[model samples]
Target: MQSNQANDQWFQSAAARDIHLDQLKRVERFNGRAAMLGIVIGIITEGLTGAGIAHQIGLGALVDGYAACRTQFLPFCF
Candidate 1:
């Protein structure tokens, strides 16, 4: 009787684990689809705004200058 009870408990635990794994896999699939959708939206928005890759490089330069000023504690930065 004890052996049968132990086997029953083990089977229940295994079934529960399988159900949880299925839910996680479904969630991961949804996340991947959502990420792809976001990338498409970003591309469309960038195209409509006319901010090309060159504009992005100029922005990066400004950010780098700001970082250098902060690190040097320059008076002009204040």
Candidate 2:
């Protein structure tokens, strides 16, 4: 009877551990999605208002393209 009780206790603890892990994974997913949404909003606001989120996306590519054009073709670069 004592061995049966011990088995029951072990099963309970194992089940609790699995539940805790599942909850942790859910929380992490929620936090990641929330953070991504916030960043997207910030980027859109910046794009619409000329705010300092200028460093957010493909601005670097634009700049590099412009520079290459100026050096290779445009005479007005000076």
The candidate that achieves the highest lDDT relative to the unseen native structure: 2
**TM, every model:** 0.64, 0.63
Model 2: per-residue Cα lDDT over 2-60, one tens digit each: 99999999999999999999999999999999999988997788878775453455475
Check candidate 2 and list the clashing pairs: none
lDDT assessment of candidate 1 = 0.79
lDDT of 2 at 69: 81
The stretch of ten residues in a row with the least summed lDDT in candidate 2 is 51-60
Model 1: per-residue lDDT, tens digit, 1-78? 999999999999999999999999999999999999977776776799866444444675566568789898556762
RMSD of 2: 6.8
Identify the leading candidate in terms of TM-score: 1
- Stretches of candidate 1 off by over 4 Å are 51-78
Instruction: Report residue 6 deviation for candidate 1 (angstroms).
Output: 0.7
